[model samples]
Target chain A: MKALDSFNPLAVFVYFMASAGIAMFSMDPVILLLSMLGAVTLFVIRREGRQTGTHLFSLFLFLTLTVINPLFQHNGRTVLFVLNDNPITLEALLYGADAAAMVVSVLYWFRSFSSIITSDKLLYLFGLLSPKPALMISMALRFVPLFRMQAKRTDMAQRALGKYKEDNAIDFIRMKLSVFSIMVSWALENGIITADSMAARGYGTGRRTCFSPYKFRPQDALLLGLSLMLAGAVGAAMALGGLEFAFYPTVSKISPDFLRLAAYIAYALLSFLPATIEIGDALKWQYLRSRI
Target chain B: MKPIRNEKLRRTVRYLVPFVLAPGFVALGITVFHEKRYAFISLCIAVSAVALFATGFDKKRTGSRRLVIVSVLTALSIVGRFIPIFKPVTALTVLTGMYLGAESGFLAGSLTAVLSNFYFGQGPWTPFQMLSWGLLGFLAGILAEPLKRSRVLLFIYGIIAGALYSFIMDVWTVVWYNGDFSIKLYLAALVSAIPYTVSYVVSNVVFLWVFAKPFGEKLTRMHIKYGI
Candidate 1:
């Protein structure tokens, strides 16, 4: 129960966002490796061993993705060998590595985020999220499993109708063939049901309130305060553009190191926002229970 | 509350809508999509394909109402693609795909690309944009039915689709722009598209996992009722 409530969504979101901005600022393998390692460490501590391993594997994936075109690609300076007269240069390798690093960091960040945010928390964050547009989005997110279950059921039903095959690929192909019609039908019917549900619930006419199982206790206040501080720091850094950099022509000139470092510190602090919120809430609840 | 999806009105819309599309297609081609004569042809074919699909699948318990609702949903999903501030392509397309068929998702995506490129001074990308965005939508549409109800699965799908879409576009650019087709050039091509690919893929997941079921389903329902 503690673990369930302890999962932090904002921590995951900011971690990835910072990763995005950071990826642009620096394509250094070392920087990327550091971030990846940190993310892996968090996963391990969380007992998400498999995820840690999965993200850790990104280094290899980065290699494969980068090496593909360059080994086969034929671009860069300091050509190592001519593959059928195509010059494969060191520059291309570096470029590939850089691209790979960026991609992997982003991927890892996302994986971390998804693990933390549950469907229900997402709803609470967005509110019952029921303006027609909001509701549709919420439904799509919710529909994944429902649709999958329905599809599984539909497939079984279709198989009974003699519409499926046994071979894996063949079965897939067959299912794909018949599934479209049924899926569309279901989506439409569900769309109608959902719309009716919303209208029946009296949606869109006025400001609507939402009910959430989770709420900010004293910890929420602390978390919110910390989040604001982090934001303000990063905001100040950006206003002065302390984190800007230009590395082309091998002339790497990074801006005010102090501010950049400070910004990064703030970014790192924000990554703990969700965790802080969780722990804070846990503490308050624990105290209240003890009092009771 | 208001009946957004009326069967009779949907039936009427299917026949009436495609007629006005030719000019729109042409305009989309030149001014919007910015392609040559070939773009016009492809756009025409694409529009007809959409209309035919709507009518053909109309009676399969999947009436035009669903099609129309999902199409509008798909279109709305296009919002995130255009708005970088809250760019949630995964979330948007997942919702779109969940409701609309893969074909509709493809149609919406391709149409969005074609239409949106207009803002960028529509150039050679009309057909290319159509193809690239079409594939994304097609993928979303195909996966939407099964994944509509599962945010987790939908989010994952969004990630894969985003990467695949970027890969496809990279290949296209290499083929179109890089005449030599050498390994180095290919590597360079792949490398360059990485940022766009990553951003798009991430956004797709973020959007889908976060919004698909709640907002996606609601708008779709409204469209069914409103007919727009």
Candidate 2:
């Protein structure tokens, strides 16, 4: 759990921003596969032997998205099959797979992102710009989980009172609505109390001082520099058309070039840095324990 | 009291920022530039619009309080997404808009998307969700008087908002599939997405029917009590 959290917030934020950005922007299948591998590896390491059943739904979504594209889109030269006079092409199927990989990889990255970057880190990143909205965002993040708990509490109380019998769909919805309204009023009253407390504490009364637990250490700076350099190399390659692929007219073959290969390596390394770090750390701990 | 010299500037910004932000950044980012930098730029625009609306639309004295209210509303919308199929995010955003100003509504709606995507997933489609929901909230705020007075108008607006959200998302889907927007492909995408769109409309209407009146009354009472 503390594996990725050990890094500075700035480092984690930059890594994700760069990785997710590259994953979304790059259409090259090789780059997309690399990003997906990195994301899945990091997700596994982060969960640390936990059941991976949670990602099955996203996988199902990926398969559906992948299959839907080729069916709806009839393009490319190589016809795989014809259904209802619509030609299904290999290029379209490949393109669909590529897009699905991109989406699923981005989703996996976000799954790790929410776990690594807590509300405090998010506020710390945004608070530098405007403290009020930053505070609001952090408060909103806090209240999400709080209100979920409140909803459960209300549900239990209503059930105990024999008021929330789920006999029919309409009755169940009505019961939920009543719980929601109770939560709404509770949230509103909570807001007033918070606002009064903030006002009394002289919030927003001049320059705001923020206290952050994250520090930009030398290692953090090193990680930031490394990620930026790798991202810059990949971006330069992309701009130079070294990473372009088109599938609609025909599946264009990518002749492996030195520059493109180098860019791919750099991008792969950049994405895999976090997972590599966690694995390396775990190995070191294991080695030390065995020696002792 | 000294006369504020930036009154004209503030007034111009009050309208100009949202205009430039809601359409300009998102459209250009999606249609024109396929670069990674544009994605970051669009995100910045969305965040700035939220900040501007939170601060620029209200008096300074009430700013923090408004922020608190918007935050809570955003939180509620996020939690509202957890209630299975009939999500109340749209209803809550509209309620916020009807009670608060358009800017507050937009902020609440957009922030709700951004925040909840933390749990759902973040991708290129996130900004579009923010823009669509934010615009719905903004429009609701503009028609607040009528919406407050007429339940029928509110319901109609809810229906439209639901469809609008689906339409915007379909645009994303088409663009994502084809790598460029095409009318033919878009129509096909719309046809495929019909079932999802219908569900969106039904959920919006059902949730709004259930949640709006009770939520609105509480917000009104809070507004009168705290003058926020």
Number of the top DockQ candidate: 2
Model 1 compared with the native: what TM-score? 0.49
Weakest ten-residue segment in model 2 chain B by summed lDDT: B1-10
Clashes within 3 Å, all models in order: 57, 0
Q: Write the per-residue lDDT of candidate 2 for residues A1-292, one digit (tens) a residue.
A: 3567877887888889889878876788899999999999898878832345757876897888788778877888999999999998888888888878887888788778888886677777665544555677889998988988988999899878886667878778778778877888898889889989988989766655456777777878888898899998987777667787788689778889977898899998998999888888899889999999
- Per-residue alpha-carbon lDDT of model 2 for B4-50, expressed as tens digits? 23335445556777787667666645442353334445455755565
| TM-score of candidate 2 against the unseen true structure | 0.83
Best by TM-score, which number? 2
Q: Candidate 1 on B84-156: residue-level lDDT in tens?
A: 6446544554455555566556555654554344333233334555666666667766766567656667767
Candidate 1 differs from the real structure by a C-alpha RMSD in angstroms, to one decimal, of: 14.8
Every model's TM-score on chain B: 0.63, 0.77
Model 2 alpha-carbon drift over 4 Å, by segment: A48-63, A145-183, B1-61
